[model samples]
Target chain A: MYKGIAASRGIGIGSICRIIEHDLTFEARQITDTAAEKQRFREAVEAFVQETTAMAADIRKRIGPKEAEILEGHIVMIMDPSMSGEMEKMIDAGQCAETALTAVCDMFYGMFSSMNDDMMRQRASDIADVKVSVLKKLLGIEDVDISKVAPGTVLVCRDLTPSMTSQIVGGNVAGIITEIGGKTSHSAILARALEIPAVLSVPGIVDAVKDKDTAVIDGTEGEVYINPEGDILARFVLKREEFIRKQAELNSFIGKETLTADGQKVELFCNIGTPKDARKALECDGEGIGLFRSEFLFMDNTRLPSEDEQYEAYREAAQIMGGKTVIIRTLDIGGDKDIPYLKMQKEDNPFLGYRAVRYCLGNPDIYKTQLKAILRASAHGHVKIMIPLVTTVDEVRGVKSLVEELKKELDAEGKAYDKNIQVGCMIETASASLIADLLAKEADFFSIGTNDLTQYTMSVDRGNPNVAYLYSAFQPAVLRSIKNIIECANKAHIPVGMCGEAAADPLMIPLLMAFGLDEYSVNPVLVLTARCIISKWTRAEACELSDRILAMDTEAEIVAALKIAAKE
Target chain B: MVSKKMTIKNEQGMHMRPASLLSQKATAFTCSVKINYSGNSYDCKSIMFLMAACIKCGSDIELVCDGPDEEKALNDISEFIESGMGD
Candidate 1:
């Protein structure tokens, strides 16, 4: 067994088919490179370009356009006149098909590798992708489908491109182990969306697993087994069955009310970043929309989205829920995610640096545009807008001021908005959670953003691999922070809830309930498990547990107590 | 070459981003634009050269343009800079 960054979540067993690797530097056969040979190579390259363009279109048809955009970017590079000029030069230099192809790919790869542009870096992946396709075509293996490998097969390769992975039909895949990529790469993103059990960045996968040998893979843990012992196989079978059963249970909760065993009703909302997620929210029986990250409105396009464009999207979301609560988070883009137009500098520490509401406050046009859109769409359904990364009372006042200013603009312009729309803030930073009482007095509500609160309280970045485990919302400091926000809201007569990754944890649900979390929002898939956890405990029982956990001082004691409580 | 000396007030310095923002706006004019920092000048249109200047947060830089719209360009850019990149 080995550990890897878990890209997708699941467990499976399969026979290993050590896939053919394409990582070798191209060793082109020599060519006479006469005028005829040059002409032939250019024609072949053009053909490849045309075919890839068509393939990109097909990719769009198969996957959603967002996923397919990764390929469409490549088509632009392939058609670049400068790139074609480079290839023409290579063909004139008397290089053979293989040699010319290698030279062109290497030159393009070098240029892109040195590029600071993220989009160009992503485009480079396309060059590599097409180069692989051209090579497969050259070898006469382009027609052989990977589905021929049979069921229950684990495909192992030195590396697999996004196109290569996507070509492998879903549902037939048992597991996938690769020599390259982390969670952020394109292929990994596709794999994750498909929910295939996968492990990437594994070292020496080729040397250990023999072809045709049975292997059991745990995608959740990034573990692989080769010719496992009987005991291990027994455990794998049980684990696999348990995973399936758990998924079935989560699926069973489709359109069901989220009622806990003790009948304490907690709103289970879906944390989404896209309009398409509204469908998933409805499918999961999400009672309200907890977090609708509006950054997508700013990203993936030139200039900010128009008010009507934003209204159309927001209205679509509101219409989908049939009057369900849709709590939209105003543009939270910052840190690693930034717009070139925003004129932001690289900070030594991005997560803790100026971002979110600060960026909005600095660029009032952007915020006001968003506020106008949200206000305009409020008539569509139960819409609530929340400000992110608030750390000061002044920031809360600023948001209120914007809402008022926007309202005044709307009223003068005769634009309609729900006059009674609720405004709220996310207690993401240590400063915000600490002074929750004062901010709560200003805002109508609060949602403890555990992702950042855990990071700030423990000085551990949840995204940082080195200390991600230490950044636990269940940790005493983090729990205390949540308790403080809830306690403050309770004092100020405002409601507080949690809408972070921790909100979905069954083990933490009891602890959260004890702390008086009024609402819980999680991933769409985890609605039932969280609901089940909430149902098992009463308000009084939860209040008691909250008091005890708040009184505890050490992380160890908190974890131990939660573990014992989970068992009970 | 015409120029306006200015300081970056947006917490971040007069570095790459403000330079880029200023540069992007300047290119809309039918004039050539440049920025000078600490006596070294750079082409305002080049994001690379501007970023390479290594302007830290809360630092100062100068903006210059040589074209028919240089004055208006400088004035608008100066407001963008003065307003801490604007809200």
Candidate 2:
């Protein structure tokens, strides 16, 4: 069995078809006629453009225009004067067409590959793809057309280039395995767009499997089996059916209101990092933006983001959410997430010191810039301020006072904003849970950050291997803390939400529902799945189960009881 | 020749989308369009050059245009940059 990064969900059992790397090796020779050599290179480029244009149109029709833009970007990049003009210069100076193309491409590949940015590094791969395609066109090489592949063919390749992925006929290819790429790579993105199961970054995968070999890929588990024994195959076949059935069941919940079996309605939202992800939240049917992490505005910039720049980012998210609640967390910097420009001193216990609301309160000017941005954005939609890692009631009061001051400034400047904008605290620390009732009184709302809540409640550093066993949210202490936080918010008559991995856990959903969680904020992809889980039990039913589980003293006991009570 | 200095207003700076748009816009002019950033001049008509320049948000850059329609080119490109390059 081979393990790989699970790029897409589902199980795929099919016959393998390996796309071997092409041999574009050519000899560099002096060209007698520079004009003819340049013409040859130009013709290859023109042919590449024509073919790519057709493929882009097909992808735009089948998958989406956004995916097609990758191919279109190839067109723009290849035609750039810095690219083609340099190649023309080499060709004019007596280099062969192939040599000239390779030289220019190699120069760009080096420049992009050596960059520190991930996006620029991705461009390096893109340039490699373009070079191969144009080189193949020049060499008169014919590719094994993916469109012509038989149904149920599992394509194994070194990597799926954008042009290669564009040729994939829907429903013909069952799965894809590649030696390179991760969840965010182009190959993975294309596979998800095509609704095909894929396992990527499997070392030696192409060399391991032969053509026509029967392969079973559990993309959800990132596991692969070649020529699997009878029992294993049967088990996977059953699992595949079950996955498909569950997917169909989840699809039925899309465009429908999130409700419990006994008719208790709740909001299903998404936790996003960037403003652009708001569109994905809408696409996934998320009702609102529950936790819009504002750190991206600072992290992605070399220096502090201007108030207007931050406002634009927040406003873009607000506009995309279309008046839905967008709870923007103030810059949660310092600790493990340090911005060099901020000049944070190194600390022994970074996570416990100078983080989130603590750091924001220390740097009043930076905090005000972010607060002002969120305030300006509230005019466009239902924007709220959320303070992260709150350990004291004073943190909430500090942020609220800052918001009030910023509101007056905006009012004086004739800038519009939501007057009733909410300022909330994230109940992540043990102290926050202990004073949840007090914090709830001062704050407009509460969001339980279960990941850190569990870490702090159990005193288990998630990064420390020795105490990793105590990091589960299913721990009795963590569960009690969560229940108390939600109850405090309920008593204060303010809405409470969970914006952590636990929110999407099927086993924890009932417990959260029983605790009267008003919102469930999960990764955008899990919106429908979470809604499906939420709809399984009524408040009374969840509360009844919770009563029995809450009596358990051990984490294992609690987990076992919840698993037996799991609705899905 | 005509030139104007301004800060890049787009949050993501000169990424692929904005760079492509800027290049396409610059290619439409009859004048030569260039952006001078950190003592380096980049052709505004080339997406590669623009991206390679890495003119991030908050970074100040000078837009220079020269030729038959230098004034119009400078004004048009400057306005586009001012509008955050349609980010």
Best by TM-score: 2
Each model's backbone clash number = 10, 0
TM-score on 0 to 1 scale for chain A of candidate 1: 0.69
How is the predicted docking of candidate 2 categorized under the CAPRI scheme? Answer: acceptable
True-vs-predicted CA distance for residue A453, candidate 1, Å: 8.6
TM-scores of the candidates in the order shown: 0.63, 0.90
lDDT of 1 by residue, A445-496 (tens): 8888888788888998667698887977778777878878888998888878
True contacts kept of 2: 0.44
Worst 10 residues of 1 chain A by lDDT: A73-82
Q: What does candidate 1's lDDT look like per residue over B1-87, in tens digits?
A: 578876554433443335445556656777777777777877655443454454543356788878888888778767776765521
Candidate 2 lDDT, tens digit per residue, A66-151? Answer: 89988999999999988998889988899998998899899988988898876787888889999999999999999989999999
> In terms of docking quality, how is candidate 1 classified?
incorrect
TM-score (chain B only), all candidates: 0.76, 0.98
Tell me, by DockQ, which candidate is best. Answer: 2
